[model samples]
Target: MTITKKTVIVTGAGGGMGRATVEHLLEAGANVVGCDLNIAALAELEENPRFKAMKADLLNEAAVQHIFAQTKSEFGSIDGLANVHGIAQHATPIEDCSLAEYRKIIDVNMTSIFLTCREAAAYMKEQGSGKIVNIGSVSTTRPRPGLQAYVASKGAVESFTKALALELAPYQVNANVLHPGPADTSMLGEFTAVGSSVDDTKKEVFESSVPLGKLLQPEDIAKSVKYLLSDAAEMITGAVLHVDGGRNI
Candidate 1:
């Protein structure tokens, strides 16, 4: 799938999956505008002429709006969006999970996408075509214990993306969800239970859950993102594409 001359906005571009997606899109000749709170991580891609790094808080409405505006101003048009910014829920039973913690996860994982997608939809509607790929989690299908908050947020992402697909189809804008399995990113360690050993949980719990017997790499998810954002997936809106290694089965 090729995205030559396309302008795509990638949120959480500082993170493992987001960075990989930005790189892949850049390699495909897309004008990539990467946004993340951690500007330092985005700096790594500054050397690429096709890549533009914007440090912005996804949760902030103004920042999100500014990202879309700046991206359009820079690239002349917005062709696609990859909503990859999200946070993992720490393993905690419902009784121990605070309302604040739950809302934080929802805000980051779900609400941020809402803000970004809304902005992109406006721009794309005017342009008459666009593609949007929201990153979800395999846990939305194969739920694990103590991830209630995270799973709920991902579930919302899937539903929301589907809704967008239907709403935007007439406008020629496509929306879809990409559910990745347990990825071997630095954030993986943050999902460990309070009293659990991070290493042990990774090996015995996370890794073992994937039938493929290994963690999904960042590039694996990136490849799927590339397809979803390309012309090859033009008819793939309202779909949930799982990049998981049989984990949902």
Candidate 2:
């Protein structure tokens, strides 16, 4: 199947998984608009004619709505969306976690995706086709004590994808999630143990988690998302594509 030029919106595109997804989607010949709260990171892509980066806080529903409005104005319509923006905890123990922190994760990781899908689905329904790709975690089904908010948010993401898929199926709008093992991102370094500055030990732990004995890369996750947005996955929806080197299995 051939996938032609399409309009795609990638959230959290300032960097990390969002950065990787946009790169792959653009490489696949899609025009991209990325929403990110980091203005500088968003500005870095200003040189690309096919890539437009908007600095907006997805955690704010109004900001999410405005971002999509601008997205539609930029390109007549959006054909795909990659929900790669999410946040992890600061490694505080469960008892030490604050209500504020929990709310922050829920708003950014869960609520933001809901707003994106809701607004995107409206546009896609009119176009009669669209793709939604969400970034989920292996921790949804697995346990990670210090990451309570993150885990809960991902669990919601899985359910949200499923529910949205069933509702959009008649309109040919597909929603799916991708769960990836640990990868090297700026956020990863921040979420590491207190002692070490580098990510060697962190990488080692993730590599050890999977039978593959290596940490998965952003490109690895991007590849799976690319497939889901391609015509190859035309018949697929509500699938939680696992790109964790068999670790989540």
Which one wins on lDDT?
Answer: 1
Tens digit of per-residue lDDT, candidate 1, span 214-238: 9999999999999999999988889
Candidate 1 residue spans exceeding 4 A from truth: none
lDDT of each: 0.93, 0.82
Q: Please tell me which predicted candidate would have the highest TM-score against the true structure.
A: 1
lDDT of 1: 0.93
Each model's TM-score, in the order given? Answer: 0.98, 0.93
- Model 1: number of backbone collisions: 0
TM-score of candidate 2 versus the correct structure, residues matched by position: 0.93
